[model samples]
Target: MPRFPRLTAAATAALALGLLAAAPATSDEPLVTEARVSAHFDLAAGQTPENIALDGDGSADLTFALARQVAHVTADGATSIRATLPAVAHPATPIVTSAAVTGIARAHDGTLYVNYATGTSATGVWRLPPDGGAPEQIAALPADGLPNGLALDEARGMLYVADSVRGTVWRVPRAGGTAAVWATGAALAPLPAPPAYGFGANGIKLRRDAVWVSNTDRGTLLRIPVLQDGSAGPAETRANGLDGVDDFAFPGHGRSVLAALNSGSRVVLVRADGTVTTVLTEADGLSHPTAVAVRGRTVYVPSAALSTQRDPNLVLARLRHFISRG
Candidate 1:
């Protein structure tokens, strides 16, 4: 969801209030619980949950940069969407820029990594103050770009950024150092981009061990073998049901993977052995479901109509607990 933030005043910010009333933006805070998003909560109209990452202590929290909000919900759910979250614990800073938030990554300190569309000649990655500070342009993405996805290798303290246009992944050194090419998808002589369709590697997942990439245009879940020299292995296609795949995550449990088929208009799950099944149907309300993320029990999916108000952000309430069970 891209925003045309009024003027250069920067995008607006929203935070989950009430219980989060006095929560400090400091790195350490019990603001989020360890339990993934669980059942029982209501959703605000037009709030689109974008991506997921662990807070300082590993609590499942989702960043909804587009809605200019962040919501705490389950990574999987069983009942209705409302049944997933107990309540909206916190509303995040409306740190959304004019560009719709194509992707979001979380820092160990709970800071958010934001990606915006290249409107006109603008393209780059922005860092939302973990607590309360101004966002800084860390990298200026290539112009005429697709959604550049990102993942933080916590152990290595490196940020892996995927650029579909250039068909390359860059490794940004820790603590805001220069970025270098870590892995190149299209650059790989093995998995070259298709002539007709580009392999738009948009979403990235840095697990406890390796890295997983959602090849949007390729319709495959790529398992990138981590390397000591940083040269990624030839990606293995973990699943094939992805149709216009976007972003996905392991939902904290690591038994299954949830993916968004943007053009396909649905959200699907792939089990351990690459078993694919439909979880959230378009019938329930998925209009061009774009990016997705999971907390503890909740999985947030933002259905975008491409700047159309008719199809505002469609929130999939409780998700974690339910998807986990199924």
Candidate 2:
């Protein structure tokens, strides 16, 4: 098991204090982009990138939301196919019988974890080996539930999954076992009425001893503590008012996070104390930015461009200049 290093207690406290003393974010004083590091590179026409996971060597593994394929993008902007899913069925009852792979997580040893559902069968969590072999089913969820986000607590040998339809966060062992509901609160539930996005907990990440999740339709961020007994504590709000919070990334070792404002078509910096900073907006060239992956100084953003497919591409930004060590 492997764990991402976290900010020291003192450093995290300092960031919270800094955010408390800073002024609120506004359009007129937005956080500007430091630099664009990667050249825009579009995928094959008709393909849309969904989730992203760092491959430990500065490269990233990407999932296609429409195509049945997974791809790898290098630091220089080159892309290559890694895996593809077989044709799946559709049940007559549900409007949607199948969903493309929408979430991906890479283990310390390079294995990839993907989330997808096919018709009325139980949703399968497939594991892809690093050496390029057929994917194997490691875990399964209810046929009606939709798993949207995945987070690996490598140090604890646990995999945390966000079930968008069920409005629950499930905890499953990495080595395969029964998955149980680990955390659930009002924040994880979907909007009360129809015409809603039908999304609840959309993004999940494990940092230190806490597991964080985002509510897409509600635009809220919540987290729960992982107790010594390997059980989850109560969920608490970390931030709110994000119009379309999606997948996010924690850069370096700080408490601040970069979250993709999907419907807002922007990426915003969320400080420790809930202060928000508009990092990149539509004016800076973004179209439905869906997921963010941070590794060292580079922040990788995969824009779905569902409406503006003509310019669909991945954007990498240099961030050392804008991020504060505290």
Candidate 3:
């Protein structure tokens, strides 16, 4: 059976206060009306959609976290296979028991980079050309690490990854160089569980000189500054005690983020001041929603469905009065 650890005491408190540490930007009115959005796409049974990347034309390419395939999703929810990851190349490690593609990001030139954990020791970041050519292995991560969320800092020529197992963030050069550990903190470690899920920092986003990351097990959103020397500064919590926080997107530019609650089967809008509003829930038709992507006012989510014992699928929701700063 699929397992989702219950929220710890800290997380429970945050949820009670609507997942905010400061007053909201405006009135207590909900950010987006619940009924204004609808499903934008669906996936095949057993297709575990994990992360999504928006293309130049507004289409989204999705990566299956527990599968070896990538899918191209159109604006209307149409999907097609884009690539199939090859089998594990290196010897296996006990750290990463599952071999799957966990995260994906697209470059401005239309190229795609994907992180594959064939095993802990066999994990690597592969790059695919815009023309769908053979994938090129760019950088191999540590044998004890598990790479998950991905974000690109084009100006810095760096691609950042969240190592869920190691509880650290790594910086990989876009032009192919050795990957280096960029930042880490206590907040990135998973909390105690009867059966551990091996999840910590799950989602990462870059805005200006700061990078934001979400801890799945700890239910916290943290921000780390990128210094003048391109090194990471101390990590600070922006919000805590979130519920089932998995992957998130900055829909209101840097003003707010839309997060997917994998275990709760809901999506929430979190403001700059830490105000949170439930944008969609299971009652709104989501089922174990794992990740989210934003393009303009539209938010896309992939429901893994394992928690709800249903087939995995993709759903879309639109905001009524939301404005994106991106």
Candidate 4:
């Protein structure tokens, strides 16, 4: 599971109060509507979906964090295990308790790439072939760091990995080779040790000639330009005040984004102007929502239920007033 900061008694109480005090939708037409649980996962079986990758057929591929399995869910909500990573004997991971799969990206040819944090030399990016055979490690990342979010640039044949523990973004070739540090700065660094388990860069995506990242500890969304020479330019803060922001997806053609606030147990819409609108909350069956994926008019949210420990499931919502770019 993705590491989270240990909340103090007062902080926990404040979160509860904040959730209770959240204002209801005042807009005549809400951005998200008709939210409902599409599939309920078995928490006892460690089937918590951490991140999501959508297929063209309205299906989704998810990384079952603690289960170390990649699962496929049909449009009708039926689930099947696609691939499972090998179990680690003993892990020396920091903050996070066990070894598991965190992020996943599906290539155009049906190839699946996932990040596995085993706290050993085996920790790195692994690739599952389209033919459904065994998976193999494609790139080697830091053994001590937690690789949380992954994004594939199919056109460029590159993969960007977000390391939550190390506070860095790594670049790896799609053909499989050594990983290189693409970007690192204070914006990506975790907060000092007071709260503990403060994850830095949690979620990542490549969009519009730039790489976007979410800082879970700092609660900020950042954008780094992809320079002309294939190098990273200056990092800019695109949005802030988003506590517990995890994986996000850009819906439609414009700059509007749908982000998951894991600790807040909410999914919000961050507009192009930087204003945030709380679109979905706990009442929408969000139990520690970990990621957001938009396919056509449907928005998919996978709740890890790490804190709630209730229903770890997939919630589907309709995107109102959305116009597809394609």
Model 4, which residues run further than 4 Å from truth?
1-26, 323-326
lDDT for each residue of candidate 1 in 133-182, tens digit (9 for 90 to 100):
65565765555554456787778877777666555666776466455766
Ranking by lDDT: 4, 3, 2, 1
Reference-based lDDT, each prediction:
0.53, 0.72, 0.72, 0.86
lDDT of 3 at 107: 92
State the lDDT of candidate 3 residue by residue for 1-326, as single tens digits. Answer: 01243456543222110112333446666555443223233333336677888886777888865556788977666778898777664535323344667778899899999887655545768888999998787999976666888888899899999887778899999987799989987888765553666678878889779988889878888889999999999998887767778888876545578888876788887777787778888776677877888776566777766456455777766665554431
lDDT computed for candidate 2: 0.72
- What candidate 1 gets wrong by more than 4 Å, as runs, is 1-100, 117-122, 186-199, 307-309, 317-326
lDDT of each residue in 1-326, candidate 2, tens digit only: 00001236643222111112233335465344454535354534435677889887898888775565688988887888898865555531122233556688999899998876554453657788999998777888777776778898888888899877678898878887677889877779877535565678888898789988888878888878899998888888889998778889886465678898876678988888999878887766676777888776677888766544435567887663344432
| TM-scores vs. true structure, each candidate | 0.65, 0.84, 0.85, 0.92
TM value for model 4 = 0.92
Per residue, candidate 4 scores C-alpha lDDT tens digits across 129-218 of 999999899999999898999999998899999998899999999999999999999998888756645689989998879999999888
Off by over 4 Å in 2: 1-46, 91-97, 307-310, 322-326
Q: Candidate 3, which segments miss by more than 4 Å at Cα? A: 1-30, 33-45, 89-96, 193-196, 323-326
The candidate 4 region of ten consecutive residues with least summed lDDT is 13-22
Best TM-score goes to which candidate?
4
